[model samples]
Target: MYDIYSNAREDSWRFTLGKCGKRKLLTIGLNPSTATKEKSDPTVARVQKVALNNGFDGFVMLNLYPVRATDYRTLPSKVDEEAFSENIQKIEDLIRSEKDPVIWAAWGESITYHSFFRRALTEIISRLTLLDVSWVRFGEMTASGHPRHPSRLAYSWSFSPLDMEGYAHSLRP
Candidate 1:
């Protein structure tokens, strides 16, 4: 069965890996990188490890934006409206698939790469607030208070509760 979901094939504009059971730890990254169903990238590998270590058997990976860029610096200077809207719908579906979903805020400082990052996150937060989801982060937040991205984290690190509302406000301009 294909647990990985995407709106397109070549330039996948929206991607979500929702394997495991209903009890999943959903992670929100700044955007999707190069990971696919056939292979795993460092971020995806790290997320899977963290989830297993933290009591989750499988994980759900989502992102503020879905454009697959090898680096955040390469994401289009602006987001396409269709991609943004579709990604939100995918996010909502993931949320509804679980009970009291526990989400990990792992987008890190890249949230500042563009104004759209915050806007996309704001939309995510709005949708999450409609349900009973738990927001979490790994280790201490950065100096500017963004969540810790898996790439920079120690494998031994664990999760901590993140104040979703306050965290969102801190990112606003």
Candidate 2:
């Protein structure tokens, strides 16, 4: 098993490249959790299961913030601007490298917890739109109006391209 946090240092970003297949997926989430000895976080496992069921052989996981905290509420109040910028660049590079992957908008409702995180998400979504990458909305949206997170997705479901225009308009400037 590959360790996602192998190179991680205190307060630094960390990510794992999941199993690969012919049909590719890119998932953007809030942040990673500390993976234990055997299994990954339930959220990660949920994403993998859905991808495989939807005919996506593999997935590459990224995050809005790469800091490894179990919950967004536990994150530090101050956002690391430099790390956030670098992580965004890394995600963009990965998207550019992949061949028209189905990018899953799986950040869930965590965006509401912090203004800085929401802003970062909006910026990333804008970049995705500019690049013409597809956004996959899984199942129904939450009460907050964002797409359902992987863990919250319907047991049997499919993904569709999100309405980026309307979504962008909804974001506070």
> Number of the top candidate by TM-score?
1
Per-prediction TM-score, please?
0.94, 0.87
Q: For residues 1-173, write the lDDT of model 1, one tens digit per residue.
A: 32765656475765686567646889989888877777788898898889888888778889988888879898779778888888888898878878878999999888898888899889888876778889999988988788988898997777888898998887777
Backbone clashes for every candidate come to 0, 0
With a 3 Å backbone cut-off (N, CA, C), the pairs that clash in candidate 1 are none
Q: Which stretches of candidate 2 lie over 4 Å from their true place?
A: 2-7, 10-12, 36-39
| Reference-based TM-score, model 1 | 0.94
lDDT of 2 by residue, 69-139 (tens): 87789988898887678777777877887887678888787777877777777777767676768887888
What lDDT would candidate 2 get against the real structure?
Answer: 0.73
* Local distance difference test, each candidate: 0.83, 0.73
